[model samples]
Target: MAEKQVQSRYAPDLMAGQVALVTGSGSGMGRATALEMASCGARLALFARRKEPLQETAEMIRAMGGEAFVVPGDTRDEKSVEAAMLKIKAHYGRLDVLVNNAGGQYIAAARDITNKGFEAVIRNNLIGSWQMTRAAADHFMFENGGSIVFVTAISTRTALTGFAHTVAARAGVTGLMKTLAAEWGEYGIRLNCVAPGTIKTEALGRYPIPPEKWHELNRSVLGRMGVAEDVAGTIVFLASRLGSFITGEDVYVDGGETLHMGHDARDMIHPDMFQGRQRGDGKNE
Candidate 1:
């Protein structure tokens, strides 16, 4: 296979006639992916819990001379999601792409997370994917096939601590993608996921940045901290003709961060950065 190229064409004519429904298309990676797809010739149906952001994304698409539709609602709500699907079918009469990217996360220790919190993450991450996949599958099968991309996270595989609930839920989504790919192959439906690492976006501020973690984050990967466009490009590929045969797989867009396993440089740092202090010692004290 050829190495993937990272590129974005504003208001692309490539996706000119294809239709796509992207959940959580209001902001972050979802917003970027929606724009890129629209540029490439895809008509977009943008979804989110809030109307304002969805409208903004749609407007951007329109500005790029691409067609767009704003669908505002909770994707986890099957009724709402199916209604959105119905609207798309009414407007375009065909569904070519589905991107399940709506998800939530909060910082908390595993035991500290409440049942509600855990279930909330699962509902949005896992169940929401199922709902959209089911709706899209029905329409897609009728058309003989389409592509579905799920926005997953690398933390699930690497064992991130504070987001235990999310880790579990997202891992399940990866599993779901694999199974669907197997069963839906004959129908021509392709299912895959983009596992994003740390990408700077609106969500960055919400996650609580501690100082200039940029250096750490930049060095966090062999390349650098990810930008929204990095993941967006991968999404564009998965939804385009470029990814025709690819299915039932997940790509880590984290720039080799996962490869830092036993060789984690943080551990190799001179045991002298804290000369006289023991591990976790409060130097300020």
Candidate 2:
């Protein structure tokens, strides 16, 4: 049997006449967020390093009777970001929302993390997001007043053994958003961060953990892995009028996983730590 296509609960015109830019929108959470925003009547500008995926996302949106423009560029490049913003301004004439969702990282112990790897992750996650935010503010949002959402990780709320680089970079993003929320408030620009727990996306396959282990490690209060749409709804809310007075807040969409901070150092460092343990008996096999 086919799974049912769940429709959005938000009003169809919730974001009418708004222009939203979503980075890393070629797949996973970024693509999900873009679709949701379009369903709410917002014109979308999809950004990603690859043009093919961006084109695909745009096609999907257009098929649903929504408008989308594809902008392919690396977020880490200042010139690329500036050019993208310029194109958006020229095409849309105004920007209403900016979703900084493009970032990536690999799992490695702090000792194993090299300087090159650390710098790459920071540049991609922190510096790239900051550049996009600044360009948007300078180009349109500063005077026009808009919303910005940064997609961070649940690791920012707790320590995970193999994700030293990601935790550091995302933590920086959280701090940046908080400070900007205060500084940009007078300009009518809103800034916030959305931290997702262990979401089941294509990107998850990059990790070496098995499916069952992933479930056990990420067993949140909800007792299930999150889907991309789970994070998308929260983002759409922040970018819409519903979240007008809300800013500088780091919203955790992690189904209470961050409450206990999820995994411990052992679970992350040793993937097979519980392999021989019996669940109810608490005995090693």
Q: Which ten residues in a row are the worst by lDDT in model 1?
A: 1-10
The TM-scores of all predictions, comma-separated, are 0.87, 0.90
Model 2: which ten-residue window has the lowest total lDDT?
1-10
Instruction: Give the Cα error of residue 234 in candidate 2, in Å.
Output: 0.3
For lDDT, the strongest prediction is 2
User: What is the alpha-carbon lDDT of model 1 when measured against the actual structure?
Assistant: 0.83
Tens digits of per-residue lDDT for model 2, 50-73: 999888888888877899999899
The alpha-carbon RMSD values of the candidates against the true structure, listed in the order shown, are 7.4, 5.8
Question: With candidate 1 superimposed using the best TM-score fit, by how many Å does residue 187's alpha carbon deviate from the native?
Answer: 0.3
Distance from true location, Cα of 142 in model 1, Å: 4.8
lDDT of 1 by residue, 1-285 (tens): 122232465445666679888989988999889888977888898889999988888878777677898878787998998888888888888888999988988899988999999999889889988988898887655466888999999876788889888899899999999999999898888999999987878887776766367547643456668888889889888878888989988999988878775574346864655564545544532
Q: Candidate 1 has which clashing residue pairs, if any?
A: 11-39, 12-39, 14-40, 15-40, 15-41, 15-42, 16-41
lDDT of 1 at 19: 89
